[model samples]
Target: MLSEPEVAKHCAALLEHFADYCEQMDEATRGYVVRLAWELIGDQMDRPSVRRTRRGH
Candidate 1:
């Protein structure tokens, strides 16, 4: 089994790819991509960390 840190790293990489996909996608597609990203991260990471806004604003 992968360690927590390894899973976090993989999630981060997937988030980056999702960001890239969002940039190139239409509005509807971007929204879907973002939702998929949120679901993936939520499943893999701690609830508190995953729930925080990305910008920390």
Candidate 2:
């Protein structure tokens, strides 16, 4: 399992490489790609780390 710091480091690198990739794509495609990338990353980050139990036993 990766720690949060490791995830951040890899995500930073992924965004950097993604930027380079988007630059080489056609202008019409770059916008969609960037939006999709952000959506996916945002979803990943927004997910809860664990499922919570109810207050009652």
TM-score per candidate, in order?
Answer: 0.53, 0.47
lDDT of 1 by residue, 13-54 (tens): 878877767677899988777666756655543456556446
| lDDT winner | 1
After aligning candidate 1 to the native by TM-score, how far in Å is the CA of 42 from where it should be?
2.4
lDDT of 2: 0.67
Candidate 1 lands at a TM-score of 0.53
| Candidate 2 TM-score over all chains jointly | 0.47
C-alpha RMSD of each candidate structure in angstroms: 5.6, 11.9
Could you tell me how far off, in angstroms, the CA of residue 2 lies in candidate 1 after the best superposition? 10
Instruction: Give per-residue CA lDDT, model 2, range 1-57, as digits (tens).
Output: 234888878877877887888868998788676666656566442347845445976
Question: What lDDT, from 0 to 1, does candidate 1 have?
Answer: 0.69
Alpha-carbon local distance difference test for all models = 0.69, 0.67
